[model samples]
Target: MADNDVSQLSASQQQALEQFTAVTAQETKDAIPLLRRSQWNVELAIAKLFDGEAADPVVEAAERAAAPAAARPQIPPPSPLPTPGPSLGAGSRNRVTISPAPRIVPQPTAVSRRPSLLISLLLFPFSLVWRLSNSFASLFYTLFPFLARFRTATSPPSRTQTTRRSQNPRDTAARFIRLFEEEYGTDTGLEFFEGGYAQALDLAKNELRFLLVVLQSDEHDDTASFNRETLINPEVVEFIKTQNIILWAGSVQDSEAYQVSAGLGCTKFPFAALISRAPSSTSNSQGMSVVSRIVGPTPPQTLVLKLTTAITTHSEALERIRATRAVHEAGRAILEQQNSAYELSLARDREITRARREAAERRAREEEFARAKAEEKVLLAKNRIAWRQWRATTIPKEEPVGKDTARVSIRLRNGKRVTRRFNGGASMEEVYAFVECLEYLDESATDEETPERPGGYAHEYGFKLVSPMPRQVYELRSEKDGSERTVKDCLWPTASLVVEVDDGEDNEEGEDN
Candidate 1:
């Protein structure tokens, strides 16, 4: 088929095209229209190949008159019966038949012949009698089990009957294989599929191969010849191998095989069927369609032809199905990759959002802390100014001039000299206060402009006084307590005090003030 024409077809349809071409050996141009006519059914398309053609009325009449006998199917008379061979064993019911001459065997009719209702009614009495006799015999055997063995030995040779239930399908399969090898010899060159019926069907369906099912009846007249001549033929073996056909065979005596025969509706022994995946219109519930069936004995040539027809007809359709599966798998893989990428991107975005939120919270806390610290600094500066104003007013304005008074000389940090007098009872704190107000004394000359004392303020002076000659230092703020001793205790009557800047921890607030 042309590329564009094939592309327009669905996967199943494309598969049908390949199958039709392979089986019919038709050119692409011819196969496309033929497949379309069958609605893309491979089996239907192959069936059409053998269908009789429609003729014009005049042409049909002329042709019929010219070759009336030729138009009708030629079914030759039955061939002479083959001679009976030796029995398989003394007690064995199976009898082998020698190979007979090759002859054309007609395909089975689609409709089965059914007896009339009158005939069935007439036969009902005989069937009832037979059932009654069998039931009595079974009851007798059950009662006298030891006598049953003697009865079996005297009975006519017959195939063993079995129940319908599966009794170890694998074992049954293995047993069949072994029996087939023993009967036909291992050199037959044909190998049977090594599994149960269901397993064989699945293998054929999945691999797009043909499954050939052979059911043998040991008691049948033609089974021996069929196995010996037709199955062991070199041409048949080669065709099966080259075409990759899965062969599965079982004897009717086996429960598993009996079930398969009943299911396939086999009417004759030595039966064979070719099965494969086909269009839904022609397939069974399991999607398997029977391609060809050979009942009774068939020649090796006919078997090969039948198998070839089935293989070619279905090959292309399976190829298309495989292609479709591959495409679907690739699409699933791509979808998974896209989903993985999207999940990763989502995770990254979530991480970024969390980090930004945390950073914003940290910045808010830092800004709040700085604002509180600035407010605290303003309050401390106000308290220090109030304490300084209060201390300036409390200093003695005029020098004490009594007998108990003491005179002291002080040098300020500004390199200026100042004289001051204090009472004998005056504490050292009073002396320091006098020096602190010197700035006010020089600026105003009086205490009239002094500020009021402030509450709730603990103040520390930034400068300290020291006697330079002895190197004794006096701090404005006491380490132990706020109390101080009188200056007379250290500089009684006369003393020189030097004021230098204090560089202790108390200087922090003083510098800010």
Candidate 2:
């Protein structure tokens, strides 16, 4: 076969050819000829390789050897080997040995095949019954539309439309008025608002007016006479129109009107109730209060007098409530203004306090920086002086041996005497620096050291080093030749240095100057 032709074989075909050659103990050179003759079919080449008579006995022997020893059947005698079949050609006579056949493993069947078909057949009758029942129900509903409501009632209940129907008070009252006019004629002079009882109550509350609710039952014997004689009276009609009142009338025929009548607990027919706004402290439930109620028929003058008295009493009460509310509002305004002023003052105080604290912090930082600089300067000066002393360059040898240095004794204000030996050639500035260092060291040794002060000294007083024995004040001065004198030139071998603290006035003057 061509080299490219071998590459064209599928993976399974190549694997099967390798397994076939291994089982038959055949070389690729000899097997390829046989495989090509069979069109590279691995199973066909395998069958042809074992087709001779010699292979049949070897296969039978392997099968017998592989059987379980206990499962082998007992026989009277062993049968003789079968005679070889007649060979037609040299190729057919070629014997090829092979292993036993591979064991066959059963696979599980798919769930969607037979099982699904059976389930479908089992559920068919139930599905048909359900469809038939639904069809009959639909037919019944179509024939009697009203009966559909019963079926719907078994479902989850929803909000009814009655609430929306009753919301429009004006429409409901207007319809009732039309019905009343059709039944009894419109000759009565009593004017009524086209609204429900709730609307009338709300109007009376907002406008601070009275509400007149008239409930009439058509079955009552006195309803007609009461409306004609008392309600339609000129005096009653005039009072209702002239006074701060809203009249709302309804008949018992309407369901809404009957509900209102039942809620009011009215047993008598031709009932007239005067509703008004109660005092603020008193609870006006449902936004209405029954001020006066007249049951059955009564004279027009008596009804007018009762309405007038109730209106006067309630009007005076409402006026007092208005006055009280006005006073409370004024007090509340004043309190709010006072509280605003207090808050402003508190904010101002906080700002001032914050500024003072920040200033103090800034001063502390500046003092700390200055103290650090002073300490560095002192350390550098000490290093320079020690280097000069070690080099023996600043010592004056011209003076007498023992008198080469000056012994200066200083007396402090606290009655403490401090004496130290200094170089005779040292300048007066050195003498002052030594005194300042001594005072700083002394203050540090004490417990009452004030670190918040700007400088190392406790007091703000200036110091003047003087010689009391010579009666002369020592001052630093630059000569014309640009040369300054030292402590040795002023007070030779020994001198008494008295440190005098300046008074407040002298210190202030020195600062000013």
Candidate 3:
């Protein structure tokens, strides 16, 4: 290319041209056309140069004209024409000749009638035998599953578009590779990936690598040479390995391989394709696309050239996609962390609210219990005062005036002495009550001043009167029983008694002893 024309190209295109000219050792003017034809692919341009497609016919003719005459290739002489033959005699020899008429051939008539009964009966035994044989074969296959493989092997080949059988793609791929290696030998440097075609595509897309699919047809004449020479060539194998391409090859005889070939629109045997992530313009629905196709047999250099061109063109786009994915992943992780923290804070708030509610309820219950207990104590005190006032009124103003009158002298619990006279019919409880109401006995003691007994209350004296001479005790019974011993029963006539507090200490001491 001219210097001015080269400057008009982009930086990448100019670089590609320079590399192309350097490798092919061709003049800039001569290399531009080849590079343009290969879309500025240096590898492809170099391949075209070595194939002699870059030669100029005008220049070749000029070189031939400048050469000496003796060195030129000799031209062979043209062959002589043949002599004319003698004419045949007429008339005297003209005898009459008869022409034969055309014969009509019978045409076949279409049969629209049903088959005869005799024909059906004649074929009945053969049909029956065929059905029996099929039944026996099916039974055998069912009894021994291993025989199914043999039946498959013996089956006739089906149409290429139709799948023969469904099998595990991994197993199919491994088996194909094993058989390939056995036929081509292990030294074939091309490493075929041992997995299904779909799996290979997924791996290549996720890893941002190129996938090279090599589909071989055993019946094709070019298959053997292609595997032997082009695929195993050192330059081709090294290029594929350096590019980190995922190579997956299979025979067209396999169901998966047949389906792949049909899907990729393979019109020739020994087909190979370079597939990678679809470009941004077409990526909405397509994950991958065929970037380059090499059909029939190709030289190692041409195959490498096609692969290199496709990879170099798409590498930039793949890098951009990878960067976008990393940013999205980082943002998603941060969002998840924030959500988990919020959930923990919400749970802690709920727990604190529950504890406060329980504490408030417990305090309310305790306050209610204390208020009820205080009210009960005040009611009991009032009942005791009312009973004392009532008993005081029942005491006589003076000693009974009768010969059966009894006098008693009692010492109160507060160390005070009290003398009282009771009627002969007075009970022992009367003497006890006389001592109890000694302070309440006054001119003001009256029935109107006394209050009713406390509801559900049973009053008992806290002290008992004891006889000093014989140590006999007079204990008051509960008023609810309404029974009391008379004063004459123990303290008739005259008696000296001491009132002592009836605390439970004596009962505790007795139990301890």
Candidate 4:
């Protein structure tokens, strides 16, 4: 056997010994199947050596290399091979049989996929409920037009465009101004005023125009908030009252604020409110052109809906007002009815009082007429007595002091003076009075002959002029032509020229001075 190269043991005998020990108790003791298989290879080789087969170093060496190693089994990572096919051979056989491992088609993991089905099932119920509820709600709301016919309609809703947030106040203000200008119109004339709001308010005050402060006052960003000091001042109110100016109040958010602003004072689209196209008016047939507010420009159909809605709202409000008025009238009528009964009871007393008043008025009028007639008779008699007295006491009786210039007067045209004569018995007639002129025998009484009066003559009587009130010679003139007149003696105050015709020039030949 030693001479048989010691390595070449007969394969048939070695196979029989390995098969016997492979099922042995030693291989089974405290070992997993793979471990037992590994130790058995060494155990079988040793048995063969002891059983009269000399150790073949080549076989031993080959067994050491070929046998499975006692090492930690590791889980193989997923293969990158594109397909599952025969990759490695199990044994050295010329005719190879490959048992290809089954391909595991990758599926979605349980973590991501399992919850989706449950969630979908849960949401299905909710969606079903929502759809059902929505349909019912819509159906119910649909009948509101009929149910709420008496209720006032509201303005069609509009949404403000979302503007980008900006830190710059000027940028915000400019954007706001642009929006207003666009919504209203291209502001021409007084449209695009970049002046300060507070300054404009102050300027408006000077012109007797009041400003409406429409804003949330807590916000310092609004100009109206800055005018708080002006708001509470009594003097401001007084000034406003005297100037025929008024302050309007409302929230900026309300449409009434816009309406009120339009009514009072607005720099933009003043003509729009004034020459407003009524909501129902289809064609702007009037020659004046109008543009729609671009804040939320709507098509004609939407605008028509809005118009009808507005009309309905206004009509409702008017109806409410009328209903209130009717209620008030009924109450008043009840009060009047109660009062009428009381009045009916005192009808005889009222008639008696009325008759007494009439009688008293008649008696007073008769007495006044009798007294006036007597006064006229006495005045005429006194005039004749004055004439007799003049005849009796005569200094210039031969020349007749009035005969030298009988009704002397002066006429003025645009302050240029001319002289004439007049005939009557009295001084120059005042502007407010219509009477014949007087031949003044007294030189001191004449305006031109007497120097300019030192005192304000008319105010001494405690009579001030009012509308159509008379000014009684508040000023008098001393002239080179020896004729002068009072301020009131002028034709009109607007024209400051005195034009008394032939009044007193001739009578005042010279002043005593």
Candidate 5:
């Protein structure tokens, strides 16, 4: 068969064929035929090459005796053969005469079979008894279902049952303590927090206390000694309590405690770590830093000394931080107060400025009113003077002729007297004009030139032509004719007139006119 025909053979058979060809230095074709004849037994194929008809005992003995011993290479013994029966007598064995014929030994089948059958027969009654017992018990359970509860009550609780019963943190901690005490003995005198690692950290942060985390592993050889000597030491306990440190203990068996150990990169059992916030940390984001670590078994004094040293060093820095914070707070408060004062002062100044502006506006209004009143008085006087002058010019003037004239004497308010003569036909307006001329002339005689007159009769003085006898005032107009009357008609021929200082009523009337 071709080399590819070897692919059909099993892996072991193909390996044996290749070995046979390589050892014998024969072609694959030559080795394949021999391998096929030998049923793929490499050892038997080699043996066949040395002695033909190697399967026949007589022929193999004769060849071994005849062939020179040096010419034949020794072959190692073949592996144990399969058990012989009629199955080995098939035709396939006839084609492949590979090794010596296996010896056929008769087996004592009855002798071996009889003992097993007897043993089974002896154990049959016991199996029947067990089945009957099981049936009875099952029937009892079916009849009285409540009896099942008694069986469960008698049985011990499983791990899952106990776990469910103690799911609370405090219960779990109690159980942990109980188990630890049972294993290591009671009265350990070590205080342990009932909460988890996170709760311990939060307590430490809130109280500003150091966190002492003790991770215990039961598998460690020194765990008991460390707990008894270092952890339970009275001095260590007292110091931790006095320093306000929170102590949290956990076992390696707990899932959360195991996780904490892994995170802290703990390699040794009975590991103690001191954790606290960093000195410069202002928020939780900065997190806690491990201040000191004690591993394995440490003496109580040494552990205490290390913890105290860490506290002293970090405490100084913490004090400094608090002092700086206080200073900053004080400065900020002062700045706020200053800003408030400045704002108050600014408000007061604005109020004062507004008041001053209002006062100035009030004064300006009062001054303006006074000036308007004075100007109104001056304008009224000019109007009255112009009316008097027009009246004087319009009245008819009569020159005194012969004895038909009237002589009028007037007494001025200054106690001066003035006498004027008018014809009997002259109007009374002429007499009033003569008195006004006397005022102007007298002012001009004393002063270099009188200031421009406003043209009304001086309101300070008023004149009326009154008769000394009967004390009758001259009428400005005739009652009968409703025309301008002559002075002779009012005073007749001669009369005395008086110029008197007017009272407030006359001055108001003059202004109205």
Candidate 6:
């Protein structure tokens, strides 16, 4: 009320008071308690000079007027209620309802008072160490392309040292696996091997040993005892080979298999436990690739799943695989050389056959020419004899030729006869030429060059006990089946050489002695 109104007001204004309160506007009239209303009694001055009583009145109603202020009150300006409007289009059987919101869950305490320190630390949201380790590993893999990434991870902070988990191990593994599978998927590239694989095996020259585990299959090759549909397929082998991942077949023996399992941190792997030997530093001749399989307590099929999971979680085992798939380079080289030699030998044989055929043809032509010449010579000799007879009969007088012929006979060794005949030629040139041609005709001239003796000695130096040929001498001879097992070439080791005088002496020599 205004000051003038307050002064003019009756005793009821004496108790009037101003106070703040909260209530539903609809119930504003009745909501204000009678006692509180009584506080607004006697002229019931809301404030300043008032012309009306308002259950909800504004403080501005108390104007600076000393006279009573004009006041009018309707239901308090519709208490700002939310406007109801059409929601979007869809219709549900039930009207769209906004149910009470779920109770807000209190955020987990950063430091839980109930948890042990170790538990809290372990469960700590910070995987920074792991992330960093992973990043560093990924960087290393990228930098060293040939370094086959495997399950590589630092043991979780082994006591004192900070450990790093491969932050992006999956990424690295996936990359390696992709590359490996790509390379190995080819025929004989890196797959289950049989006999031919043995030859291929000879080509590997690596720091580690690669063992192709042959998981058995009962469908076609029933020899395999491992479960069907669970065979260690070529894809797995390719994956291993591409990654330079060692292909190891698990062993049936649990203890022996445990070594592999423990190393892999898994009970199963892609391969079956059907191997001749657990993958080790040793070499194996058995066709382990396709013959052996990965066998475990778990069905063969499940082994792969477990193994994959293990590899995902563990990194050390993967590195071990990389370390083991090694090839034997030296042996492979030797085998290649042998193959080359064999091929060369085959080529040489083909050339030799062609040459022999050509030689035979030449020989046949030469022989035919000689026979015709010989027949012509015989006919000429007969005609000369007939002409001589005719000349003797017709022109008996003039002897006009100075011609002579000489024949000599000599006895030779071996009771053989040697006859020498000289032809009456005008000069020696003709004979000399014939002799030269005869020498050239000798077939022995066509022989290949003789090999020198061992120890760089000439074959002409025959005085030595060891022959220039240096033939392979054996100590004894023993034959088995049809082949000769030995020869007595090294008999000199026990026998002494000496000149004997017991036999083959003439009677005259005996008398002289």
TM-score per prediction, in order, is: 0.40, 0.31, 0.45, 0.15, 0.31, 0.19
Candidate 1 has a TM-score of: 0.40
**What TM value does model 2 have?**
0.31
Each model's lDDT comes to 0.67, 0.61, 0.67, 0.34, 0.63, 0.33
For model 6, the stretches where C-alpha displacement exceeds 4 angstroms are 1-305, 309-368, 371-375, 384-513
Residue 50's lDDT in candidate 1: 43
RMSD in angstroms, all models? 17.3, 40.9, 24.2, 48.7, 36.9, 42.1
Residue 434 error, candidate 5, Å: 89
390-492: candidate 5 lDDT, tens digit per residue = 4434434445555878777778655678676787777777776666544344334455533443453444325565666677776567677779988667756
Instruction: Give Cα distance to truth, residue 29, candidate 5, Å.
Output: 99
Worst 10 residues of 6 by lDDT: 97-106
- Cα lDDT for residue 149, model 4? 24
Q: What digit string (tens of lDDT, one per residue) describes model 1 on residues 391-416?
A: 76566665668777788899877677
What 10-residue stretch in candidate 5 is worst by lDDT?
97-106
Model 4 CA lDDT for position 116: 79
- Model 4's alpha-carbon lDDT is 0.34
RMSD to native, candidate 4: 48.7
Q: Which stretches of candidate 1 lie over 4 Å from their true place?
A: 1-160, 163-171, 174-194, 218-238, 297-301, 316-513
lDDT of 2 by residue, 1-513 (tens): 342254676787577668657655677655655564455776566556543212346644664787665664432121222333333242122211111111112122224444487787998999899999989988987899877544332322122212323334566688767776775678666568877676676777766677888887654556778877888888988889898578888765554555666666566777877776554324334444666667777889989887776665456545544544554566688899999999999999999999999999999999999999999767655554343232232222223346667787888656678777777777876666555444344334453533332233222225778888767777655454557668788766888988876565232211111
What digit string (tens of lDDT, one per residue) describes model 4 on residues 367-401?
99999999976665445334423322222321133
Q: Which residue pairs in candidate 2 have backbone atoms (N, alpha carbon, C) closer than 3 angstroms, thus clashing? A: none
> Which of the predicted structures, 1 or 2, would earn the higher TM-score when compared with the native?
1
Per-residue lDDT of model 3, residues 1-513, tens digit only: 142277788999889887665544567666665666566787655544443344556744764686665664432222222222222232111111101111112122334686699988998999899999989987987899776644433333235423334457778788888888898888878788888887887788788788888987775556788988899889998998898999999887777776677677767777898877745325324466676678777999989876776666556557556645654565577788898898889889889988988898888888888887778766766676667666777766756557777788887665667777788776677777666666667633643555444466677776778998788886554355667777776678888988777666222111110
Look at candidate 3 and tell me the lDDT of residue 281.
28
